[model samples]
Target: MTRYQPRHTADVRDTGRRLLVRGGAAATVMGAATLGLPGAAQAALPMLRYGSRGSAVVTLQKKLRTLGYSVSTDGIFGPNVLRNVKAFQRRAKLGVDGIVGPNTWAALDRATSGGSEPDPQPEPSDPKPEPSDPKPEPKPTGSRPMLRPGSRGSHVTYLQRQLSSHGFWVGSIDGSYGHLTSQAVMCLQKTYGLGRDGVCGPNTWSAVGRISRPRAAYYSGNGIEIDLRRQVLRVVEGGRVKWAFNTSTGTSRTPTPRGTYRNFRRVNKMDYSPLGKLWRPVYFYRGYAIHGSTSIPGYPASHGCARVSNAAMDYIWARNLAPIGRSVRVY
Candidate 1:
C-alpha cells in the first residue's frame, strides 16, 4: 500500500513543545513592550530653575563651571546661578528664562565640546556703593527698577542681601519679594524718616545706600531694645546691635511701657490674653511682652506688647535671645 507512515509520536510531541516555548517567549517580549520595559524606562533630564537645590543642581553647577561660568557649586540655585544661566541662554540664542531645560543642556554640551569662551559677566546698572564709603552715592530711579511685594529676580535677592547686611531681618535671602522683605523695607524707611510705604522706590534705594548698622542705646550687655519711635527692635550682644527686626509697639490707646525690665516669663506657644493672641511671648512687664503677632504693621498697632513677626519670634526662641532673666529695654 502507498499509505504514508504515521509520524513518530515522540517527534510530534517535541514539535508541539517547541511551538509552545516559542509562543511563550513571544508573549513575554510583547508584555514587556506593552509595559514600557527596560529601554523606555530610562530617566529624562530634569528641568532646573531658581530655588532648586540637590545633586542635580551640583551637576548643573559643575557643567556651568566647565564652561567657565563663575558660579559656586554649592548645590543652591540662587541668584548667582540664575544670572549665569541667563547669560548662557543669551549666548546660546535661546530664551533667557534662567531655567536649565533640555535646550539649555544641549547648548551647554555643545558649547563645552566646542571650548567656547565664557560670556562677560553682566554689569549692574547701578552698582551698590560700599557701606564704608564716606559719601554714599545715590542710585537714580531711572537706572534702578522699583521693587515691590510681587517683584522677583536677582534684584530682589540683591535687596534682601543688602537689608540683611544692614542688620535687618528679611526672613531668607531668596529672590522673591515677599511680606518679610516689605516689612524690612518699611523698617528701613522708618529708620531713615522716609515714608513708610514698604516699597523700594527711588528714595528707599537712596536710603538703602546710606543705611548703616544702628548703635544700641543700651551698651551694657546682652539685651533687647525696642525703639518705639523708629518702630524697630534691636537684639544687642556685647554692647553691639546684633540683629534688628521691624516691630510694632502699642497703639495710642495702650502704649508700651517705656522702661527697663527683666524678662520674667516666656511663653513658648500662643498665649490667649484679653487683648489678643500673643505668639511666643517674652513678658517684660505686666501684660507687656515682646511677642510675635500676625499684624505687625510699620507703625504702632499693638495692645501694649512689642509685636514682631512670627518668624522673628521663632528665631528668638531658637537662639534663646529672649529668655527668662534677659533685660528688656524700651525707649
Candidate 2:
C-alpha cells in the first residue's frame, strides 16, 4: 500500500472531500444492506487503482517488463509508466487508453504467465572481523542513542530521518539517540514485533524502507495540549484536534506533574505499583498512566497518572503515539 503522508501544503482538500464522500457512500451501502435492503449496487463499486507493487499494479508492471518495456518495477505511477502502458495496450489491440482495466489485465496475464524474470543478483556477504585484544567499548544507557545527520558514522541518524519521514517520532533527528529516539524505535519495533532494542539495525532499516509507500505521513510541529483545569487531553495533529479525552490528573505533592512529555513505550497489560503487578502502561516519564479506573467518578484521583476507563485505555493504546519526545504539553 502507498504510505499516505499528510501533505499539509498540498492542495488535497478536494481529494479528501471526494474520499469523504466515497466513504460516506460506502457507509450508506453497509447501512442499507444491514437493513435487508437490496440495490446496494455492489458490482458498480469502482476497482481501486493500485499504483505499484500492489496486486493490480504489480501485474501491469510485470507484463510491461516482460514484453521488453524499459520500466523499473518500482511501484510509482509516472508519465513514463503510463506511456509504456499505453504502448502495450496499443500493441495488444486493447483499449489503447494507457489505463489498465480488466481487459488489459486479461491480455497481460496471458502474455507473462508463461515466463518469469531472471534471478535477482545475490547480495554480497561480509565476513565478521576477528576479535581484537581490546574489546569494543560498551554503548551508553538512558534515552536512546542516535546519530546526527551529516555527521560521520551517522547511519543511525540517516535511519532516524527515514523513520521520522515515515511518521515515527525520533526527536528532532539531530543524530543524538536520546530518550525520544529510543522511545520511538521501541514503539515501532513493538508494533512490527521486531526486537525492541531501540537500535536501528538491518532489520529495522528494512522495515523503515518499506514505509516509502503512501509517502509516510508525519505529525506537524503543532504540540499536544493538555488542559489541567478542564481535565482533558487534546491531541493535535497539524493544528487540528484529532482527538480529545477526559482524564484525571494528580493530587497533592505527587500531583500529576503537569508538563510536556513525549510518549514512549506502550503496554497493553503492564504491572504498576513498583510491586510488579499487571496493568497497562501508557505514557512514559514519571510512570503516570491512562488506565482502567472503576473508582474514577470524576476529578483528580490518580497517584500521578491519568485515570481513564479500561475501554478508553484500549483506544488510547491503539492510537497511542509518542514518537520519542513528541511534545506532551500540559498546561
Identify the leading candidate in terms of lDDT.
1
Model 2 residue runs over 4 Å out of place are 1-223, 275-278, 322-324
Give per-residue lDDT, candidate 1, residue 248: 93
**lDDT value, candidate 1, whole model:** 0.75
How many residue pairs clash (N, CA or C atoms closer than 3 angstroms) in each of the candidate models, in the order given? 0, 20
Off by over 4 Å in 1: 1-139
For all candidates in order, the CA lDDT equals 0.75, 0.49
RMSD of 1: 17.7
Best by TM-score: 1
lDDT score, candidate 1, position 122: 20
Error of 1 at 305 (Å): 0.3
Q: TM-score of every model?
A: 0.59, 0.32
